[model samples]
Target: MQPCVLTSTGGAPVAARFHAPPGAVRGAVVIGGAMGVKQDYYAHFAQWLSEQGYLVASFDYRGMGDSQRGSLRRLRADLFDWTDDFDTVIAEALARSGGAPLYLIGHSLGAQLPGLLKHRDRVDGLLSVAAGSGYWRDNAPQLRRMVLYFWHVLVPVATRLFGYFPGRKLRKVGDLPAGVVMQWRRWCMNPRYHVGAEGAPVREKFEAARFPVVALSITDDELMTERGTQVLVDCYANAPRRVERIAPADVQARRIGHFGFFRDQFQSSLWQRALTQLQAFRSPGETRDPADGISSRVAPGLLTAH
Candidate 1:
């Protein structure tokens, strides 16, 4: 892995790492992370993809992880700002791909922001893992009470007193910029999440997105539920998509939670499934839409162990 720094359109410095394969590269991929999660958390997965012969890149958004160079109290960033970061990373990936297909592997919040990308159409395909709308009501029943406390109580109190959400101290996700936390809170409080929060402009962008997408929803995820995942899939109205609701048993595992799918332990199982989807983009004569058909409904039996 090689360290790299990218500058967003707004001039914020974004820290990133690039992994190149030993042999000829098949394609280029940019791994988009969940909110508050650092890019280093994905280093192992990026390396694994590199070993698979793809040039992979992972980056940290400004005010988070290695990108945060100054005081958190003075930092200001929102969802759109992070999207600009992704754009920069995507542009870099495309430039280095030598005309190979460029793909996105977005996790959670990472997956949701691609609709806002100015170059969304240039992407060959997208792989969304545990991606969903963050409306508290749409979350898992086991997490709804905590979600309510987070949005109604914790976020307001923390951001007001600290100028940022003290998520690290609170043991909730990770530390987040005040603007990002507040804007996300506004979206989660609404049933429509980002689509409802940002309104018509974002919705129109989602409608215009024509890239093929594979959304993987974990059955045992304590954060995002089936409805949450579907809400995000529904936003891409014009895109051909396949929704896979994967159970731990499918991979012969006991539990694969929202974050477990990316862990090294599931490399042979869940991670390989993601690679299959990425490889599909490079398959000979493959069209944007799959030859079979596209369905938004959950395909529980589609994925099997290698």
Candidate 2:
């Protein structure tokens, strides 16, 4: 895997890893993951895609992972910042590959970011893994949800008021960027800011997107409920679209809950399915579509929707 850095207009450095597939490369895929998650976390998954004859580039957004950190003191992380950062990644990837068929694989927030980049024509396909409408209605019990909301409001306030706010330990992850955490707070409290669902009209920035799309969500994702996934599915009004759902039990014993989908233990489980969806679009003489995003394979599974 070769390492590269994309410098964005915002003066942030985006770290990227590029893996050339064995033999002749059939296609290329750019991967993006959830918040506070690093690109290295998907190393096994990237290797798997590379083995399947794909040149894959996985990268960390500015202020996250190996890239430069943002001003945490100001709590300024926003989707626009990451979107611009991703724009640089796409430009560099295309320039380096010389216009190879490109696909996108975005998990969680990464999945949603591309929706904001619909005007960019650098991708041929898209795979939205565990991407959902940004509503926290079913995130937890009413009491727990209320507590979370209260904390969302209180923490930022206290942080500004007293310079520090109590934070929960992220699940095996690092600290959340202040901007990202604050944006999440606004998103959770309102359903309109949700992705892949009814909300603000497609921004003028994304109207250029007309490529084929596939959005998938897992049933057992503790962070996003089935309803939230459906909301995302409903947002895509374009043709050549497909939506897939995976119940936790369907993923064998792997328990592909949220982050588990890309983890090593569940490679053959969920990752295989994702790959199959990608391969389905690839043919011997076919060039890549600019909207198709993911290129993973799928193995046997019994994912039934409730």
Candidate 3:
């Protein structure tokens, strides 16, 4: 893993980690981190992809993780600015890919924002995990009530008082910048999610993104609901896409929630499920560990869409 700095459109230094393949590069992959999740969290996964022959890059958003310089309250970046930062990484991946296919592996918020990026055209494919619309009403049944309490009370009160959301201390979505939290709260409150919240300009961008997409929505994911996933994927009206709904039982796991797909246990199961889908478009070396002797449990004809 090589550490480097990515200069954001706003000129902030966003720290990044690059993993180079041991042999030939199969492709270049840029990981888009979820809301408030540090880039370091994706370290193992990125390295694993590199070993599978893809050049991978993972980085922090300007106001979070290693990129968060100075006081959070003083930092004036929003979700849109994060889009620009993600674009820099995407552009870099494309440049270094040497004409190999480029894919965006986005998780949750990372999945939702790719269409908004300036370099959306550079992406060869999008592989979204636990991707969904975050409108509180469409949240998973278990999260609906709690998210309401968060949006109606906690978000307004906390952001107003602290000038930024102290999510790290509160243990919600991790520490988030004021603009990010405020704007996200607005989206969560709106029925159409970012589409309705941001109006037609944003809607047009989603409509304009033309690529093949595959979204893996976990049935047991506590935060992302089926309806939310459908609505979010449907926004990419022009893309050829698939939404595969997988249950914990389907993968022989007791529980695979919103964040569990990245845990090391899924490397032969969920991780291979992802790589298999991408490999359909680009030729990648076999990454399975025969020692584990585990093949992909995501059987064919498991609720895929064209």
Model 3 clashing residue pairs (backbone): none
Best by TM-score: 1
Span of ten consecutive residues with least summed lDDT in model 2: 297-306
Query: Model 2, stretches more than 4 Å misplaced?
Result: 69-71, 74-76, 138-147, 158-174, 194-208, 283-306
lDDT of candidate model 3 versus the reference? 0.83
Q: For residues 1-306, write the lDDT of model 2, one tens digit per residue.
A: 999887876567789998888876667788877766789888989989999888888888776768855444544556667777777777766665555667788888777677666334656677888876666664534334454645466647755653323243323234555555566666656664544232445533333454456777776676766666655544444324556778777866646777778877777777888788777655444554335543222211212112
> Over the stretch 1-306, how does candidate 1's per-residue lDDT look in tens digits?
889888997689999899999998777899999988898889899999999999999999998999998877898888889899999999888777676677899999999999999879777778999989999999999898677878888999999999989899999988988989999999898788888988999899988987777899999998999899889887887777767899999999999988888899989988898898887654354433322322122122332211
Q: Give the alpha-carbon lDDT of every model.
A: 0.85, 0.65, 0.83
Candidate order by TM-score, decreasing, is 1, 3, 2
Q: Please provide, for model 3 over 129-208, each residue's C-alpha lDDT reduced to its tens digit, 9 standing for 90 to 100.
A: 99899998899887886887898899889988888999978889988889999999999888889989999999999989
TM-score of 2: 0.80
